[model samples]
Target: MRVDSRTLPLVPLLLGPVGALQLPLLGGSSSASQAPIAADKPLISSPLLQEQVKAENLMQRARQLYKIAELGEGEYNHPTRVIGSKGHLGTLDYIYSTLTNLGDYYTVSNQSFPAVTGNVFESRLVLGHTVPESATAMSLTPPTKHKEPVYGQLVAVANLGCDASDYPSDLDGAIAFISRGQCPFGTKSELAGKAGAVAAVIYNNEKGDMSGTLGTPSPDHVATFGLSDTDAAPFLEQLHKGEKVDGIAYVDAIVESISTTNIIAQTTGGDPDNCVMLGGHSDSVGEGPGINDDGSGSLTLLELATLLTEFRVNNCVRFAWWAAEEEGLLGSDYYVSVLTAAENKKIRLFMDYDMLASPNFAYQVYNATNALNPVGSEELRDLYVEFYEAHDLNYTFIPFDGRSDYDAFIRNGIPGGGIATGAEGVKTVTEQGMFGGVAGEWYDPCYHQLCDTVANLNLTAWEWNTKLVAHSIATYAKSFDGFPKRVEETSISSFAEEPKYHGPFLRQ
Candidate 1:
C-alpha cells in the first residue's frame, strides 16, 4: 500500500452509517446457531488434506477471481477497483457470493466503516515559456490554483530543503526550487512556506517524475508540485547560469468523507476460543485495478476458504478482507479498536498476505524474528522459512515496519507475520541472484499505477505464494502445539510507533 496520512473524521461503524446500508449482506448468520461437531470424528485428517489444496487447484481458482476483477473494470469508466467505486463493490459481491454458496461450513458477515477519500481533479506545473512539461501533484496536497497565473522568480534551495536553514533569505517572493531527497515532500513544502515562499516545486533526484505524499498536512505548508529530472534540468541550468526563470504551478482537488465495508468470515467447526486469523486488504488505490497489489492476496484467501470446507479444522479460522488500507490502515484499525478484551484474547495469531505476485519478484517474509520481535512473532516467521527451505526455494526477509494491514494487529499487541513478493522497491544484486529478476528494476513496475492490470501479474510467484498461504492455513488450523500462548498482561505500549513514510525511493 502507498503512504497517505490525511486524517479526517472517521465515520461511525457500518451500524451507524446509511451509505453502507445499501451493500448486500452475504454469508451465514452468527456462529450461535452452528451445529456442534461429534467428538468421535477427527478434528482434521492429514490424508484427506493432501487430496485438497493442490497448487494447481488453488492457482486455477485465483485466475478465475482475477478474471472477475478484470470484468469489474468493464462496469466502471476508470480502469480501477478502488474502494467506494462500483468496480470494488462488484469484487466484494463476488467474494461474498462465492463463500455464501458453500452450504453451512462458514459464518460470514460484513463490517462496514467510514473513510475520507481524496482525488485530483486538475494539476499542472508550467515551468518555462511553454505549458508545463508533464507533471503530477503529490497525494493529499491542498487544492490551490492561481486564477491569473501568479508568477514568481525561481530560486533553488540548498541541501534539498531538508533542514530549516536550507531555505534562502531571498525566497520570500519566489518559488522555492527544492529537490526531492533526504525528507518527505510535506516537510520541504512546510519549510518553504515558513520561509515566506508563495509555493514550492520539488524536482526528483531520481529518473522519474515525483509522485509521493507530504506524509500529512501542517499549517506551515504551501501549494506543492512535483517534477521529473527531465522536466526540471533546463530550468536548473538557466538558474545556475544567473539567468532569471519564472513559472506557474496550479492544483485543484477534492477531499471528502465516504463509507466502506470490510468482510469477515469464520469457520463453524473448530475451537472458537483459539482462532487463527488471516487477512489482506480488499480495497485498491485509485490508480488501477490492483489485481496484483492485493487482488492476489485477497483471492488466495477466498480460494482457501472455499477449498477448506472439504475438510475440518481443529481450531477456528477467520478470514478478513479489509477496506481502505491504502488510506492509512483505517478499516483494520477500526476493527481492532472495537474489539472487546475477551475478543482480542480469542485471536491466537494474525497473518497478513499482500502483494504476493510482482512481475519482478523475490520471496519475502516479514522479519519478525530479527527486527520487530513481538512475543509469538518469531515462531510465525520461522514457519515460512521452514516452508521455503523444505521446498528448496529461495526466500529473504523484509523489516516488520507496519507498512501493510498487519500494522493494526501488531500495534494492538497481537503477534503477526506474513508474506509479500515486493512492491515499488527495487531488487538488489543478491536478490537477483536468488530470484533471477532484474537487479535495479521495481518488483512491480506497475505498482500503484493504471498499468497494474491482469497482464502485469507474475503467475509463477502467484502460484508459489498461494501454495505457501494454503500450507500456513492447513498447518495452524490443525494445531498450535509449539506456538506461544497468549499472555494476559501484554501491554499495547510495548510495540513502537509504526515506521514512518518509507516509500519505494526512500528505503534506507
Candidate 2:
C-alpha cells in the first residue's frame, strides 16, 4: 500500500448512500442461472475446493516467490521485487506462464500502462548550521533543483497548508514548511510553489516517521521532502517564537516515466460478462523481498487460480496480479480507468487480498458493512465473515477505503470485498486474546522492511486465509444465487474525485 492508512468518503455514493449497502431485492440473479450449464463440470463446492488447499502447496509457492526475488532478474536487481525491477518482471512472467499452462481454462493477457518509477539517491534536511534532521524525499516527487541544493530561510505555512491562504506572500526563495494533513503532499508542494517557495518540507502529523508519496509529478510541484513529527516539533516551536530558521532542503532522485504491466486472467468456462476479479500486487516496495507485505496474498491467488482449474464455474472468475500498486494502485487504477461502461458492468465484483499472513495474525474482513460500497459488496464481505464464523474463528473488520487494489472497482460502483491478515495496524490486547500474538507490536513488524521474507509468515494464518479466499471465490463462481442483480442507470460515479486522506493516497 502506498499510504499507510487511507480513509476517504463514499464519493457520490453510487453503490449506495454512505453506510447503505442493499439494493432492492429482485428475483434470482441472471448472472448465474442464465449461464450455459455443462453437465461434465460439477458445480463448485466451497468446502471441497477449500479442502484441496494443502499447506504444502501454499508454502511451496511462497518459497517460489521468495526465490524469484533473490534470483536477481530485473534491472535494479536489489533482491527486491519493486516495480520496473527485473524481480517484478520475473514475478509477472511466472504468473503469466502458470495461468497459460492451464490450457483452455483461462485467457490470460498482460496490459501495459505508463507510470512514474524512481529511486531516491540522496535526501537531507539541515537547518541553520545545526545537526541535520532525519528526512526522506517523498516518493515520485522529482529530484530537487535539477540535483542541486537550494538554500533559503525555512518559513512555516499557517495551519496544515491545505489552503492557499496558509502560505505567506513574502516567501520568495524560501523553503515552505508545512504539516501533513487534510491534503496530499503533492497538493502542499504545489501550493508552496505557487507561493514562490523554492521547496516544500512536510512533517508527519502522526507519531511515527513518514512512509509517504507525492503521487505522480505535477508541473506546479516543487521538490518535496518528508520530516518526522518528532523532528518537526522543535523547529515549529522555533518558528513560532519569532525566530529565523534558515534551512537547506536537498533531495536527489531519478524520477522518470516508465511502462509497467498488469496480468489479467479470466476463466473460459463461465459467463464472460459477469466476472469475480481478485488478486494482490505483483510488485513490492523497493526496500525488501516483500514476501509478507503482498507476496503472501499474490501467491495465494496463484494457488487458488491453479486449483480452480479442476472444476467449472457458473459465473466467470477473473484474476489480476496488479503492478505498480505500491506506487499508489496505478495498475488497477489504470485497468478500471480504461474500461468502458459496458466493461464496468461486466465486472460483477472485485475482491482484493493483501497482507494475508501477518506474523501477528488477525483475520480482518474488508469492512464493507461500514463502507458505502456497491449494493452487492456487503454480501461479499458477509461471505468472508461467514467463513470465519463457520470455522468459529475470531475476526475483525477493516475500512474499505481506497487503500488497496479494490479502490478502482468500488469507485465505479462495482461490488468489492476481500480478506487480509493485517498490516502495520497494531494488534489490540483483545485481538491478542483472539489470535495469540504480542499485543503492542505491529501485525507484521517486518511490513515494508527487509525482514518481510518468506520466513516472516505465520503458516496457520496463511493456510486459513487461503481457505477463506478459496471459499469466497468458489461460492460466487458456483452461483450469484441470492445476490442482487445489476440495475441500470447512467450517472457513471467513477473514482475521478475522492475523500481526503487520513493517510497516503494517489491523487487522481
Candidate 3:
C-alpha cells in the first residue's frame, strides 16, 4: 500500500505526538478458541462458510496479535514490529505455534530469507540559535556522528538538487541547503558531497518536514538531514537576503543485513496441483506497531485458517505471512523468484491483504476487470463485488496497480486481486456519502505512526473485511469452476516484465 505523492499535503504534520511508548506483552489467551481435531479422526462433513465468520472472533484474534507486536518493542528503545526484530519474530512464533497445534489439518513451513534492516540510534538538527527541530533519520543513511556541533555557513542551492550543476562552487566548507524533488535524496546528497559540502540539509519541496533515505550509502556522500519547508523557510529567506545562517546537523544510525522468515501454511488435504493463494505482510514499519496496516490482514488469514479447519476443500488453499514487506516487497519477491516454473503454474490466483481496518474506512476492491485485466483478475474482483452487493454494502474500485504483495505474482503473469480499506489517501466527499467518514481526513489518521496500535483499528471495518476474507476463501477453496486453468508450461521469461512500483505511501 504505497502512499501517492500527489495525495500528500505540502505541509505534513510531525509523524506523531512525542511521548514515552510501551510495547504490549505477548502472553495471552485468544478471544476465539476451537478444540484441535484429532489426527486419526475423520474430517467434518460441513463447510463453515460466511455465516461462521464472526467479527468478534476476528477482533479477538487481532487483539491477541497486536499484543505480540507490542512485545517487539523495548529492544530498540522504540515500539515497532519491524522484520528481523524480537517483536516480529514473536509474531512468527505465535502464528507457527497456532497452526502447529491444529495437528494434521495443515502443514506449515517457515521459509527463511535475508533482508537488510536499519535502526536509528540518534537523529537531531539544531538551527537558528540552537533551537532544536523535530526530525527523523532516513533508512539506509550511513552512521554519522558529530561529537560537537560543527558550524558552517549555509549555502542555498539553485533548483532541487537533482544535478551536480545545482551545487555552488564555494560549498567546500558550507552546509548545502537543497530542495527535495526530481531525483533520489541520495542523488542530491551525493552531488552536494562531491562539491565539497560538509553536510547536506534537504528541505521538503512541499509544506511538511521531510524525512527520506539517501537510498544507499556512498563514498561521495556526506551527512544529510530532512527539514520541513516551514522549518527551512526562515533560513532560506535570510540566505536570500545575503545574511549568513549558521547551523549544526547530527545523525547516527546502523544499517545491516538480517535474516527473517516468511510463514507458509497449506491445507494437508487439498489438490496440490491447483492451489488458491492468499497473503499479507507479517512485518511492520519502524514508526510503530502496524496492527491495522497489516496485523489486521495477517491475523485475518490466521483466524480464517483456524476456522477453515472445520471444513474440507476440493482445491488447496495456501496462506503466506510475508516478511520484509516494509522494506519493499522483499519476502514476496524472493519467494516468487525461487519458485520453479512448475511451482508458479500450480497457483490459480493470488489475493493480497495489506490494510483492511482503516478508521475512516471505504470498501475498495482491486479494479482488475475494467482496468488492468490480468488473466483471471476480473473473476476475483467480481467475487468481492458480488459479496459486497449481496450484503447491501456500497463498494468502490482502486486501480490494480502493483503496489502490494500482489505485485510479484502479477509480474509473473499469475492472476491476482485483493481488498484495501484505505491508507494515507484522503476520503473524498463522495466517499463520505457512501462510507460515512470525514471527507477531508485520511482513512487511517495513525497510518505508519506510533498511534497505529490496536486502538487505531476500526472494529466494524475489520470485522466486515475478515468475513469477506472467509467468504472469498470459502468460495474459491470449494472450487475454481469460473477461474482460469493453471498454465502448466508457463515461463517467467515469457511474461512481460513490469517495473516494480513503489508508491510514496508505505510498502509497495
Residue range 412-469, candidate 1, lDDT tens digits: 7788999999998899999999999899999999998877777777888887787788
* Model 2: residues with Cα > 4 Å off, grouped in runs: 1-39, 73-77, 129-134, 146-148, 163-165, 205-209, 489-497, 500-508
Weakest 10 consecutive residues of candidate 1 by summed lDDT: 1-10
TM-scores for the candidates: 0.78, 0.87, 0.78
Report the lDDT tens digits of candidate 3 across residue range 1-508: 1111222111111111122233322133422233443455433222345557677777777777666666666775666788766667767767766775675567666677777776666766666685536355566655543433456788999998877888989898778898877777778878988998877888877876566665445777777777778878888889989998887766676677777878788887678988999999988887788889798899889988888887777778999999888776778988998888888988988999989999999999988772454578888999999989988999999976656888788777688899999988889999999999899999999988888887888888887888888888877777889777755445444344443233222110
Q: Please give, for residues 103-157, the per-residue lDDT of candidate 2 as tens digits.
A: 5576656677887777777777787766435677777777678788889999989
lDDT of each: 0.74, 0.77, 0.74
lDDT winner, 1 or 2: 2
Task: State the lDDT at 421 in candidate 3.
Answer: 96
Summed over model 2, clashes come to: 2
In TM-score terms, candidate 3 sits at 0.78
Backbone clash tally (model 3): 10
